[model samples]
Target: MYKIAVIGLGYVGLPLAHAFASKYEVVGFDIAEWRIEELRKGIDRTLELSEAQVNEAIANKMLFTNKLEEISTRQQLNPKKRISDNVYHSYQIFFEYKESYYPNSNKPNNQ
Candidate 1:
């Protein structure tokens, strides 16, 4: 079974870690202490995941931590990064590209 480590736990990492945990061992790393605390308590302030969903993921061994040292250790043990392609762009552009196949997603919607 593949071991996975996800960095950053915003909308992207949380879900990705959860999905990976269904098949592989997964650890989610985030710099934000509050975010990790919330996740540990089965709360997702981003509203992407319900409490039950988070709890289920946790039950399956999907874990969240705010320790950079732990993340570095995991990285040395298993080198990998799981960031969303959309994270590189603004939400508007990301959503546009996600919805349509047009090459020029940057064009004004009115055009």
Candidate 2:
């Protein structure tokens, strides 16, 4: 299992981190102190996460921090080394879905 670090806890980062946490060890990082505080209390102001989800994340050892120094210290001591692997990592997922509907119902008169 690889260690993962997710930066920014906005609409994008939060979900990504949650998905990663399901499999690998994940660290979600953000610079906002208030955001960190909200996360600590199992509240997502963005409505991206329910209180239960946030609490579960916390119970699972997913860390949330505002101080860079503390984050660094914790990273160094992280036996899983998940934070190091995620420092500059990027996670992208592309899903292809086909729609059966078509727009512009008017037919062109080619005749």
Model 1 Cα lDDT, one tens digit per residue, 35-72: 88889999988888889989988999887886544544
The stretch of ten residues in a row with the least summed lDDT in candidate 2 is 91-100
Clashing pairs in 1: none
Q: What is the clash tally of candidate 1?
A: 0
Instruction: Estimate the Cα RMSD of every predicted model relative to the unseen true structure.
Output: 10.4, 14.0
Quote the lDDT for 29 in model 2.
Answer: 79
Q: Give me the runs in candidate 2 sitting further than 4 Å from their true place.
A: 69-111
TM for every model, in the order presented, reads: 0.62, 0.59
lDDT of 2 by residue, 1-111 (tens): 226768788898998877777766767877666788879999988888899888888777788764444444544555876564344232111111111243222222331
Give me the candidate number with maximum lDDT.
Answer: 1
